[model samples]
Target: MLLVDCSNCRRALELPPGAHSIRCAICHAVTRIADSRSLQPPPPQGFYSSTHQHQPYYPPPPPPFTAPSPYNHAPRGPPPAVHGRKRAVICGISYRNSRHELKGCINDAKCMKYLLVNKFNFPESAILMLNEEEADPYRHPIKSNIRMALYWLVQGCQPGDSLVFHYSGHGSQKRNYTGDEIDGYDETLCPLDFQTQGMIIDDEINETIVRPLPRGVKLHAIIDACHSGTVLDLPFLCRMDRTGRYVWEDHRPRSGVWKGTSGGEVISFSGCDDNQTSADTDALSRITSTGAMTYSFIQAIERGQATTYGAMLNAMRSTIRNTDDDLGGGGGIVTSLLTMLLTGGSGGGLRQEPQLTANEPFDVYAKPFSI
Candidate 1:
């Protein structure tokens, strides 16, 4: 066995011979290490020269340099670990018997709940799951109940805790009244009783979930719905083209109510853009229906591959593309999920390019992806 360092997560581990790729136990980053011996530190300077027979001329030493100030700030520490107290709010709605009824939303919520508890180590008691099939009225996906759950997900969110919010259902776009939205439309998550209870607007979601989180807390939002981009009102947005190159934009408008980072780290994965609609399909297992975004998300993780933020987004996109292909060709869709994710919608010549956005600056690949 040989000790090797993980390039992405920086964890040192003993490598078994003939292993080409290994997942980091610390960050779960899968990387191909062809030669573990290459990770060894080089010998100290002058060791080779001193051992040589030939004499070499020594250059004059440069003047001594002053050390950096103690007050000078050092780089920030790694992100908060998910091993801390974890909480999640997962809402899945089929809008049963309604005109906008879906088939896979309820299943999406349950799948996410399972993944959180079994794979991510989230506590079952801490997870609040709301689905349309619930017999209890309070557990229904009503506007007020969803809002309360959103609030509950972030309540008591400490520095080390990992918070997740997932919504799989119909999404819509309404005219922006507050000029906070750049596209002249505010993205919304439709509740079962939206006709009477009203839709959960983007601004309120931000105020309820994103604004209150403290520094060192990590919020991972998986929104498998339409018009989900910027739903969390995070500050940054990353857009990637087919070439895998990406650009970041400041999404907050100049006079927006919520303008910048709230000292916490937020990453949102959306099913589609502000103008597009997400798909509820039955192709996940041929017989069982599920939200396309949710299916791809869970599939990407279940592959047990160590991947960066960018790589994970690409994997989800690839799965979505293949799923669309199996469903017969429609429009040319490019699906990618962002921290503030933007994905392409299928059919009707509409595109739902998934996107990833964040509150603070982060490396897409250098840092290992976590809950």
Candidate 2:
């Protein structure tokens, strides 16, 4: 009998002398055995071994790489504490040194971390940050690292848990082949390595952090990116007009893909409509440049303007609208030229409207906004 390891579970298995392959009863993995001559012990280590130099040494091949799957969750960790816990994953990709680099993404990340830690009472240890400045390779805002950070954000979440995902970066759209999007395009978050590793699509985002939420868990996603209105792929989109009248638009997938939380509540505040582009500008702040939506969102909260969901949304819109008006009117030629140069534009105008989407629809005015 020969002992070999099961390829999948690494369990030792006994093989009959003449058998070429054996199956593991424990894991049902099949292991193929090499020829008997090749299986013999390697020659003793000495000058005699040097005589076999004609055969080149070949090291074992590395482990197979599996592409990330939307449904493949991180390994389950210990259940969270019984009481409500707060955790956040804040990611900002500046694309530093590249043409796509933005001046305020790292700033956005730091501001968000400060907000969560100071105002919202989230522990610093519980927040996972991914940005260009992080010294740790695992914390860099690359495709795999970002995905891992997202998994860590919601792993072992239980009832009464509050989770937050904030991203300030370049967002783009790709053709939707899965038939899951109403607009026929899928929104994507571009990581540092997105040019090579590809963007993180909405389907994977929803599955990774949204779909697995448990009852009584709440999630808030603040996306400061272009074409991010429905980035979370939530089922209901809130459409509000200038008059403040609003209705929830049903955005459920026609292909019957589930884009909702299991039982938890999820709310997303995005930078703009699917067709609109978000701006990275210094117009909102005289001190430093920042993402328009991110700046407005933080300003609203810090200024105590976020009493209700409606109030917060209105405040953010008003802030951006005021900036737009100023830029179009008195900000003058230099400002306009700067805007064009920064945003890669034709010096026309900047029009961006913040958006809100949720797993379920309720009266925005009545519902008090919380993290």
All candidates: TM-score: 0.69, 0.73
lDDT of 2 at 161: 88
Instruction: Give a tens-digit lDDT track for model 1, residues 76-190.
Output: 1222233347988899988877777777788778878888888898888778788867776667888756765664566556788889999998888889876777889888889
lDDT of each: 0.68, 0.75
Tens-digit per-residue lDDT, 1-371, candidate 2: 45455566443345666888876442346778852111233334442435566665443443332332335544222323332399999998888788887767777788788888888999987888888788765578988668766766776688888999999999999999878888899999999999998999888899889888878999999999999999988999999768768779999998887888879999999999999888775344322556778777887887788999989998888777765433422321112212322332123334888999999999998899998
State the displacement of the C-alpha of residue 295, model 2, in Å, after optimal TM-score superposition.
Answer: 0.6
Location of the lowest summed lDDT over 10 successive residues in candidate 1? 68-77
Q: Can you tell me which runs of candidate 1 are displaced by over 4 Å?
A: 1-84, 241-243, 282-287, 325-351
C-alpha RMSD (angstroms) for model 1: 22.3
- Report clashes for each candidate as comma-separated counts: 23, 0
Among all windows of 10 consecutive residues in model 2, the one with the lowest summed lDDT is 328-337
